[model samples]
Target: MDHFLTFSLLSLLLSFAAAGDFSDDQLIRQVVPEEEQSVNLLNADHHFSLFKAKFGKSYSDEKEHDYRFSVFKANLLRAKRNQLLDPSAEHGVTQFSDLTPTEFKQRYLGLKTPAFLESAQKAPILPTNNLPEDFDWRDKGAVTGVKNQGSCGSCWSFSTTGALEGAHFLATGELISLSEQQLVDCDHECDQDGVCDAGCNGGLMNTAFQYTVKAGGLQLEKDYPYTGRDGKCQFDKNKIAASVANYSVVSVDEDQIAANLVKNGPLAVGINAAWMQTYVKGVSCPYICSKNRLDHGVLLVGYGAAGYAPIRFKEKPYWIIKNSWGESWGEDGYYKICRGQTHDICGVDSMVSTVAAFQSTSE
Candidate 1:
């Protein structure tokens, strides 16, 4: 039994060493030069295990292994830089150790958010009075679970579903997950007013709202679970579970957006989700992200401060953003963008909208 145990340990060590082109010591030294001897083997083993878990069978393929190793090296450098440059940052970005930059970009950062278009339906101005300094719809039992969009560039659908879910919950007092797949398949075609979502390619929240209004309702996720990839629209009118009365785009004013959140539930918003690919944690701001380049759709859930010692941006105000890249991504499937700016960072104030669901009879 002792010999067998020794053999098993030897095999495991060999397996770990053979997983990469470089020796464990060499691989660790390549990325983390400071701890050449201390972490050389341990870091290598830990990273190899993480990489294998992330890529699964692909980790065994020589070519894929080499490529992912390269990416892993790059990610290590990115993490180190983030730590050195903004060590005091409240939100630190380290959740992407498993995915290569290429995989991360293609899988999560592919949302193509277009410029906000004017909605023909005029919305009544919402009154703003005694808005809280901080708020989160999740606390009100309106937000749903953090979801995964798989390999599809269907962030639009996910954003739509999140917004609708919040609205439905607020209106009915029952929090439920809605279907992004339904929108991915059905919300592509133009609405009565000619507005349309681009399906997996890209889309807008307002257009998705129009599609839902016209379709009469949307199905719960249980009835139409997300498949990631697009397919033929198989929507069944009978399965309709949630419908909105109408939707309205909030003004570009940050204060107004906050007021809308306080009055409404969660919001569907667009922003430049570029730098977020490697973001593990930190208050993402204009320093690392653009304020105008809106490219990804996400749900705006709340706002708060994230601060640590050494104080990079002391008590830095930030918006709590819920993403659809599974809970393993950032801050447990959420991100914090530097907030309180008049113009905002990552265009958070650009294309914000909230739909109003008709109150359920049970409510």
Candidate 2:
């Protein structure tokens, strides 16, 4: 009986090892459409090796997971479908394409649950009007170069700084990149419970704006810089470049959001980024992505129906969003989410905050 049990175990191990073989050329060809399959076997092997190394994948018996790279192949196939479906739609393979969905979300989506309040203080409501068919803050020189947050979940700070930078530009005729690191290290109470912009864990843009007002002002990126990690607050009052007089919570109305985008320069917004994690390009909407529930913060610089290259087959209305994940992602560090209609797109109009910045302000 003991001999039989040992043999059974050995046979099971052998079966698993055989099933884990992702090296079979036929298997690769079966998963990836023949037309899309790489003609060079060596190139395919290189990508597979690099992917395995990057994710620290091992085929050891102790590793109780799909060592066959099934998830990785599925995602690549999904990306291909996304591209083919829209043709002009958004999506492509990047460093993230090789990662399993679970790994991708774990490494990137760090926003905490329980939504933060829109704003602690409220201002008078603003009247709304029809905004132009298209507009971009970058065209007006009110926007700064794209930024990357690295592995840190400091997107709230980046979003806040982008809004303040654009506001300051429109107010002082000067475009300046503010310090996200300052907020990461210093934004007080905001670090509490990770409810709103909690260091690298996550935090709210509204909470961040409030912290900026209390901190007197924020330093320029050139002065404080971003380390993408939590550290001691190195804020220097003298190095303060811009001050937020106050911030307003725009109404949930899409028309108001449009008006605010044109009048206020850029607005910081939160969205449900589940689909955006693997998003390559195209007009993102409720059909293809989740609606309501915002887990990521970004800046809305403009909105229009005109799409960008490769995905510009037709005019589909979308929000011109600026991300801090470097220029390598999306359309040069920018993404176009679907726009228009009454309901909010990914809850973008849900938690919008625009700060009023000035070079000089009285405490």
| Per-prediction CA RMSD (Å) | 12.0, 11.8
Q: How far is candidate 2 from the true structure (C-alpha RMSD, Å)?
A: 11.8
> What is candidate 2's lDDT per residue for 1-363, written digit by digit as tens?
134533553464355446755322223233334565323333544665676675455666623335444555566665654443234446555556656656665555555555456335554466665568788999999999999888788887888899999999888898888999999898755534455556887777878787888888889898898888899989998888899988887777777878878888799988767556557656664232334446778899998855543333445677889988888777888878776642675677777777788764422
- Per-residue alpha-carbon lDDT of candidate 1 for residues 7-93, written as tens digits (9 for 90 to 100): 543465455456755432233233333532131333754676665665453555778777666666666655554443233343223
Model 2 Cα displacement at 164 (Å)?
A: 0.5
Model 2 stretches with alpha carbons more than 4 Å out:
1-71, 80-88, 122-125, 190-196, 308-314, 360-363
Relative to the unseen true structure, what is the C-alpha lDDT of residue 120 in candidate 1, on a scale of 0 to 100? 33
- For all candidates in order, the CA lDDT equals 0.69, 0.70
TM-score of every candidate relative to the true structure: 0.78, 0.75
